[model samples]
Target: MKLLLDFFPIVLFFVAFKLWGIYVATGVAIAATVAQIAWLRYSTGKVEPMQWLSLGIIVVFGGATILAHDETFIKWKPTVLYWLMGGALAIGLLGFRKNLLKSVMGAQLELPETAWRAMTWSWVLFFAVMGVLNLWVAFHFDTATWVNFKLFGGLGLMAVFVIGQALYLGRYVKDGKEVPVEKP
Candidate 1:
């Protein structure tokens, strides 16, 4: 359900492109993105920061594609989005603080602060890798291949990485214990 909800706009883009034209597809994708975001806000009472940023990028690049009648804008969207996010994550690590990853994921995970810090660093690096990968594939591959990668490659890679992370996290669990409750 979450995947479908998140992917609704991209799907709309593809379908609209096929049915109407590139401009129409861009418009449809924008509309779908906005509608989905509104629905999310209404139902959930909170919106993710990432979602807003994504919407902004879609509007800018997708809208540019429509207005300029050029596909390059849409092609650049992923590269820009991922790099922006990755750069933010990487830059934000300059400050000293409690475990960054643990702060966000702590409710679901119990790990030493050191481990959490390492995980956070890994995520920072991973996003950078994803951004570079997006740029590489989008520029190097054919349009159809790029589109396919955009729609499928990302989710597949994410699923694999997440499963791998789960496995790694599982290994870090100690002494057959549940998520820890620290002593008062």
Candidate 2:
């Protein structure tokens, strides 16, 4: 489904890494990301902003990894992307006084202003932490270990965080509708 499509590049990268090596894996990742974006655009008539951002990051870092014959660029790609996302959310909230999470999901889930603010900050924190975690693993571990972490650890952490977020948000909903609550 949509989830499989979203993870197509990462899965391909992992498989390529197992069969070949980091450089070939990087090439496969770059090509896979490009193909993924193209397929999305062709089928959906448009690609999401995040998807475009992913494509740009991969092309830049992956291209550097290939051309320079170094794995460091690819190693830093995830951290860079994560920090950029975290920075964007932080700036949007602090500078513009906007809650992007609320803006995006408000139509689907109604929650108090406080809840929205908390949710946004939670995501901001998650991204920041994830970025640091990526770097820690990338530098502390070997290439094979880093690659495994990139696919398994990264996705596992994301899944856990998402599940936690869902549980946290569950309290605000009842029977598919927002539960009414008093505001201070």
Name the best candidate (by TM-score).
Answer: 2
Give the TM-score comparing model 1 with the true structure, all chains together. 0.84
What are the clashing pairs of model 1? none
lDDT by residue (tens digit), candidate 1, 24-76: 87789889999989999999988788899999999999899988989889888
lDDT, candidate 2, 17-109, per-residue tens: 999999999999999999999999899899989899999999999999999999999999999999888888889899999988888887888
How many clashes in candidate 1? 0
Q: Output the worst ten-in-a-row residue range by lDDT, candidate 2.
A: 175-184
- CA error at residue 169 for candidate 1, angstroms: 0.8
TM-scores of all predicted structures: 0.84, 0.96
Winner by lDDT: 2
lDDT of 1 at 108: 75
